[model samples]
Each structure stands twice: as C-alpha cells, then as structure tokens.
Target: MAGSRKIELTEALALGSEWRHMCFAILYAPDPRMLFGRIPLRYAVLMEMRFDGRLGFPGGFVNSQKRTLEDGLNRELLTKLGEAASAFSVERTEYRNSHAEDTTHVVAHFYAKRLTLEQLEAVEAGAPKAKDHGLEVLGLVRVPLYTLRDGVGGLPAFLENSFIGAAREVLLEALRDLELVEPGSVLNFKRHSFRQPSLNS
Candidate 1:
C-alpha cells in the first residue's frame, strides 16, 4: 500500500479510525518576475530544508483525534512559518490527494494553494523568525520552476537534492497536475533511484 497513489480526500478521510494522518502543502504563487530581464521566473513553489538535511514541504503529522486535517496543517504552518501563515487558506476543497504508507499505518494528505506574490514573499521573510526556525526547519527553499536553455538546470537540477519521505513524488505530481511542469519532466525522474557508483569504475 506504500505505492498507492491518487486516493480522493473523501475516501481517505472516510477510512477506519485506526490510521494516522500527516499533511503537507505546496504553497505556490505566480511569480511574474524575471532575472536579468530574461528567463521568466514563472512561479514560486515553497518547500522546506529540514534540520535533517532533507527537503520537504512545510507541515507535520496531525492528530486527527482532535483537529481536522486542514486545521492541523495550518497549525503546523503557523509554527513553521510566522504570522504570515495566517494568510494561507488551505480548505478541504484544496486537498490534492493521499498517499498510503500502510507499513506504518500512516496516510499522508497533500494540498496546494496559490497566493499573491506579496503574500508568498511574506511567508519567506517571516520564516527565519518562526518558532521552529533552525530546529525542525532549517529554512525555506523555493522550487525552481524553469528550465534553462541547456535543458538540465532549473527543475531537473533541483531534483538532484534529497527529499524527505515521499516528498519527492509529492512534488513531481503536484507540479505535473498543476500544469507547472510538463508531464515528461515528471516521468523522467523514473522513481529517483540513487544508485551508488563503484570506486573501481
């Protein structure tokens, strides 16, 4: 069940009360800015550089026994981000999909929200001052939403970094489904096997 994908939010929330729930979000905005007057920056997708040196979205496990999933996610946002987190509106309708880590009896729910460039910038500016700064979250990392002329930079190059848990797949699918990255680009990741090279070779 670890490999299961695309479960609807309703189906996921309806599961037997034995499963644990974790939530994360892809906070993005239309970045109509450019660098050096060329190569439009396109969009700003926010992720976190965790204290563990792995990349992930800004959220954590929620106790469904108390708060609803979205409330739990926003609660995490308030801690990982500062007062700027209040600007986020992640309703149940924005729910993307769920992933089953049946081995651990945990299911992760993903969400995506589009914000104004100003609001997105606020989240970045306030992050360093958040309660979890340098503890659980090292800092905010923006996903490169562009491909360079050489065709290997931007998203492709960014993909080389390590992602936490199923965050990598969560990112690729979010980009493809949101029409931010071409389907081919997501397919090219090919399950992200990091094969070690032999010293003799």
Candidate 2:
C-alpha cells in the first residue's frame, strides 16, 4: 500500500536522510485530436509495464550528488529507451508529486515533461532494444488522455487499470493540476472506484 496523501516535510532533511528514493518521468506529446486546435485536445501519456506487472512511468533512483533530476531522468530513459534518448528534447520538467511508498519505504518524486511526437515515436521504436526491456520493464503502454474530456466518464476507466505504487493517484492529481481533466469528474471517478469491490473480492 502507498500513502494516499503527499509527503509533508516540516524541515528539510539531510541529503542522505532518505533511505530509499525514486524518480519517474511522465512524458507526453500533443494529441492528434488537436488538429488546428479545432477539436477536443489532450496529451498522450507514456506508461509502461513494470517487472511486477503493474503500470507506471519510466525513471529511477536519483544520484543527487552526481546529476540533476533531469539528468537522472534521462539516464533512466536511456536504460529503458536505449539510444532513443538522443531524439527527444526535454522542453521542461515540472514537479508532479511525491509519495512515501509503503512496500519499500521509498520516497517517490515524479516529473512531467513534454516531447515532440517525432521524439516519442523514436523512443517507441527503440524500445525493443532497451537494456531493461523484459527485465525491469515488460512493455510500453499509453494512457489515453483524449477520453478524459468525456462527460459521462472516462478518466475512471483509465484509472481502473492496475498501476504500481502511488502512480494512479499521482496521475489523477497531476491531470487535475494540468486542467486536462475536470476535478469534478475525477472526484466522481474516485467515488465510483470506492464503491466497487476490490480485486481480491
């Protein structure tokens, strides 16, 4: 289980205080639906299947003294995406959220970045040769953000997919913050998910 809330730090801890930590990159490209900005538009999120068979973004442990967060992100990308890392230009990376994981007791930091469609395609094309493929990573998947604009419901169904750690929650919060999906819809989806029986049920 993972904490449902964000990590709250009263005072900054020493650099080495954290025993376990991780970073994830949420990369997105403009959706095809954005044709001349005339149709409903949404960004497409890159997700992947972890070795544990759960879904999550790409990225890994941070070597704070050795590299910046973006550098760490790029390193992980290279590991999972191979030489495709050279194709993408990281527009900017924003802090997404933080979660204190229960299983490993690791603090996870998430960052969102925008990439050109061509770059994303390059990464996808190079995935088969990625060093971590089939070991640390099982395969790549995409979260369809275009459905988020649906009035009846779409975000919840997307969330229904099994996501590792606090990924689902992090995505929900991030999507809300990005204004890609309405908060009310997410709230409704939360309520809907809560009413359902757990998978173990």
Candidate 3:
C-alpha cells in the first residue's frame, strides 16, 4: 500500500455483526527536556514501517477464538516491543474506533497507551531484539507530537508518509481525542487546500 501512489480503501459492505477483528496501538511517552537536541523534549508516538513499507502502528489480527482483544493487544505488544513491554503499565485502553479494512473486511480496533520516559527508553533499547523486527516490521519510526499539534492549515511532513489502510485518519483521531492535538488543527488538516499556480507566464 505504501509504494504505490494511489490510495485505496476497503470496499463498503452492509452493516453487520460479522467482521474480522484486528487491533493496533498508538503508544507514546512524554519527551524528556533536552538542553541541546534537534528533537525537543516533546511527546512522541511509536510507529512501524511494516513489511509492505507502509507506516502503521504495531499490531496484528485478533484471533478471537484464542484470545480477547486485550489479550491479543498484550501479545502484540510483547512481539513488537519485546522485553520493553514490561516497562510501562497499560494505563487505560479505550475502544478508539472501528473501521473496515481493505479487501479483508477487517474491523480494526485501535487503542492509545501512555508510557513513561523510562519505558520509552526501554522500548528503544529493546528494538534491536524485537521478535518481529526485519520480518513483519521493516523498522521503527517515531511521530513527534509537536508536528501534529502545530501542523494545522496544511499537510505535515509526517502526514506525507503513507500509512496502511485507515491508519492515518485513525492516528489523527486518537491524537485529537487524547487532547494531544486540537480538533481545529485536525479539521484544518482534513480541509487542506492547495494554491493553484498562475497560468500566465
């Protein structure tokens, strides 16, 4: 989905109870204040460059027969974050939203979790040993919160990066709901307008 220029969405289906469940998390930690650093001490979200080269949160299909959503999420966290999984508490996981996914008709369940700076460091430290690293995940990526918070009235560089399925919108929604970003900023981003060049030369 990332390599291609065209963006695609799953085909719409009738509202029904039957839907394949999937889950992902927008995990973040408060940025540590730096005396001198390019990336200021600000909150950041952990993301993954998936096998398909598309940016997305760390998670996978929910085996409803084997485990519940929470259980599945914990499993995914362990897989993606490795030993770093123990560094942070679950805090609270909310049912962010449910959206249909491409082709698979996957009903994606997204969650947002907060982590301590210590936990963030642990996650970074454990990245080299992440079980899914290089296999399902090409690499890790961080989306700085300041960019989104101040990225209104135009497309942010972060938004330019391709996201899997409905991840971009979902990420934005999570940020807005978490109070990390303003609703106006999100709204402005959605209504991004481009100026046309003058034809007369």
Candidate 4:
C-alpha cells in the first residue's frame, strides 16, 4: 500500500449501532491580547453548532467511497468554510477512541491554521450562517488555553464529548508545542462528568 496506515469503519449494533471512524480539527489562531499578553497563543476550540445544536469542529466522517480520512475532512471543511484544503495545515493525528466490542475506532486529525486579525475579521464577515448539517455554527470560538486548568469554567459542552477528547488533547499538545503551557502542567477533565451517555445506553 502507498500509505502506512489505514482505517476501517463498522456499525456496532451492540454499541448502539454507532458507526466507527471520524475526524476533527483543532483549529487554532494566534491571539496576542489574552493572558496578560505573556503568551502568544492560538484559538483552539469548539464553535456552537447551527444544525446539530452543539459545538464542534469543522469536520465529519469519512465517506465510504473516499480513500482517506483526510480527504473526507478536507471536503467537509471546504463545503463549510468555502475555502481550499490548502488553507489549513494538518498538525497531527490523534487517536481519540477505540472500540473493544468491534474492530472499529475513531481518530481525530488535528489541523492548524494561522489567521491574521484581518483574515479573521473577513472570515467572520462572510461566513455561512449554517452548514449542510443544518448546524448554525456561531463561528469559531477560541479555546481558552489559560482557563484549561482545574477549577476553571466556561468550557463548551461539546468539548466534553468522548469523541472530541482527542481534539482537546491536541489542543493541549499544541499549546505545549507553542510554549504557552509548561510541559506536564495540563489538566485532565473527566469526560463523563460533563458528557451525556448515548441515548440507547
């Protein structure tokens, strides 16, 4: 095979028939006004959904006919953002979850895109009010890297999703990579504490 890794999707009826395999972006943008201006950080986070009625990244599941997860995610982003795939950079792929009941798992491909203040303003000015999913995404919101520690508040509910946990990790990792947070000083918020269980469960 030309690629060293591959993904396969399957329906797990026993696990509420939820199909495995998905992708997400850890969208980031450098902001200089926050945290007393001591840290040059990026806005990595969730946006309020316009259709699904939740917050999430600009991504989706791989089409069965697609050869790669990146392809599917790129397509979804373009469809939603009206931009080209080259507009963003794939930072890293993080393993979010794996199913033991079946040979299926979910992976989030975290992407990083730098936007200027003017670009951000323009994006906000002309962004679509909603996506094909009918989700009225209230545009992208910066994940507060400073408030990511314990006892902090204002985290979006969708960030607590089990599927998006990897996205969170990617955010943390990116923060660390950017020297915004010290190594090994990141917080671990419990997913179950905030996330609702599957309806069928």
Among these predicted structures, which one has the highest TM-score?
1
| Error in Å for residue 62 of model 2 | 2.6
Candidates by lDDT, descending order: 1, 2, 3, 4
The local distance difference test score of each candidate is 0.84, 0.69, 0.67, 0.47
Candidate 2 local lDDT, 25-67, one digit each (tens): 8777776676347545466678899998788988888675576
Model 4: residues with Cα > 4 Å off, grouped in runs: 1-20, 35-50, 64-67, 84-86, 89-108, 114-121, 129-139, 148-170, 177-184, 188-201
Query: Model 2, which residues run further than 4 Å from truth?
Result: 8-18, 34-41, 89-93, 146-154, 194-201
RMSD to native for every prediction?
3.0, 4.0, 6.9, 7.9
Best-matching candidate per lDDT: 1
Q: Which ten contiguous residues of candidate 3 have the minimum total lDDT?
A: 4-13
For residues 114-146, write the lDDT of model 3, one tens digit per residue: 887778778877876989988997777777554
State which candidate, 1 or 4, has the greater TM-score.
Answer: 1
> Per-residue CA lDDT of candidate 1, range 1-201, in tens?
236566677777887778889899899998878866897777889999998888999988898879899999999899989889997668888888888766677788889998898999999999999999999999998998777888777877788787777888888888888877655767776555544335584
Q: How many steric clashes does model 3 contain? A: 0
lDDT of 2 at 172: 72
Ranking by TM-score: 1, 2, 3, 4
* Whole-structure CA lDDT of model 1: 0.84
